[model samples]
Target: MSRNKGGRPPKNEGQKIKQAHLRLTEDQHKKLMQLEDQIGLNRTDLFIKRVLENQDFIITKDVLIQLAKVGAEMGKVGSNINQLAKHANTIIKNHQLPPEIVAQYNDLLGLHLVQERELYKVLRQMYRVMKN
Candidate 1:
């Protein structure tokens, strides 16, 4: 025979355990594994955390890939601009460059600087999104 206890034992002890069964396709499983690795959580824990926190865990692989490609392209553009600037400097140092040509180079450099600033802003926004 057992004695009667209070209304509730404690927070965790008073709660009844519940089980949920999930079925995932092969691709879904693989994606979940990838997400687990990226988020540094196991499959069950990650799912539980997301559900309990009421958080949306939607992975936008396409957008991430596109952003990476754009970043690479921007890097290439920056590299090319750097090489062009070095060549121009060398030429200017070795031989006399016309004032008009120097002025044109300066304008091109300014344009590249503006482009770099814009790209940096976009990358920062993307980083913020990824961080959150």
Candidate 2:
């Protein structure tokens, strides 16, 4: 029978023998802990991924949770806006809507649509981040 050496195999790239010492404030430490919990990476691995892999830690899990809640509330507001627009259209058909009210309603609806689009874009970005 043949005997073999029992250690890690040699790496094609040079060994990672260097280390870095960094300072952290209270907020920074808290965020690092949050990232460890969310991404299942220790501080060292997180730093390595950030520095070597060029990964961006823009949104944390907690921030995404809060944003999701706000998005849900905004979704309800959007439903109400649609209902109001429908009622205004009915009033216009009956010639009961004033020109000033009609103009303001149009303006408000346009702004609401823009805001809703922005919200969806944010949600999409959050989804992409979580997926990766």
Candidate 3:
């Protein structure tokens, strides 16, 4: 077998290295640390990756988590609406539904409408965040 070279791989022969000096405020530093933790990159690597890749810098983990939660809530609301629709259809087919069943269905439909409105608000908030 050939002898192994244990050190780091050689840099590209045509590449030139440059150094930058940056000063960060306390808040800036904290934000940087949060990004580093979320992205799983060190400060230098994160800076280099961002510069070289021209990546979009938006949507933190917290925002993503919130969006996920909103999606889950929307899904639950949709499932509930579907169930209500099925129940309403069954009542219509029977043509002899009790008053209490009709009232309960109307109440649940109102509640689902409120949930849908809230979901729309969340979706709008997400759109605004993405637009910026």
* Candidate No. with top lDDT: 2
Q: Write the per-residue lDDT of candidate 3 for residues 27-96, one digit (tens) a residue.
A: 9999999888886667776776577655555445676788789789878877877987788788789887
If both were scored by lDDT, which would come out higher, candidate 2 or candidate 3?
2
Residue lDDT tens for model 2, 7-118: 9887767667778998999999898898789867677777876887677854656776888799789889879888988998898888788889878988988898898899
Model 2's TM-score against the true structure = 0.60
Q: Give the Cα-based TM-score of candidate 3 against the true structure.
A: 0.49
Error of 3 at 65 (Å): 3.7
All candidates' lDDT scores? 0.75, 0.80, 0.77
Poorest stretch of ten by lDDT in candidate 1? 53-62
Error of 3 at 93 (Å): 2.6
For candidate 1, report its TM-score: 0.50
**List of clashing residue pairs for candidate 3:** none
Error in Å for residue 69 of model 3: 4.2
- Rank by lDDT, descending? 2, 3, 1
TM-scores, all candidates, are 0.50, 0.60, 0.49
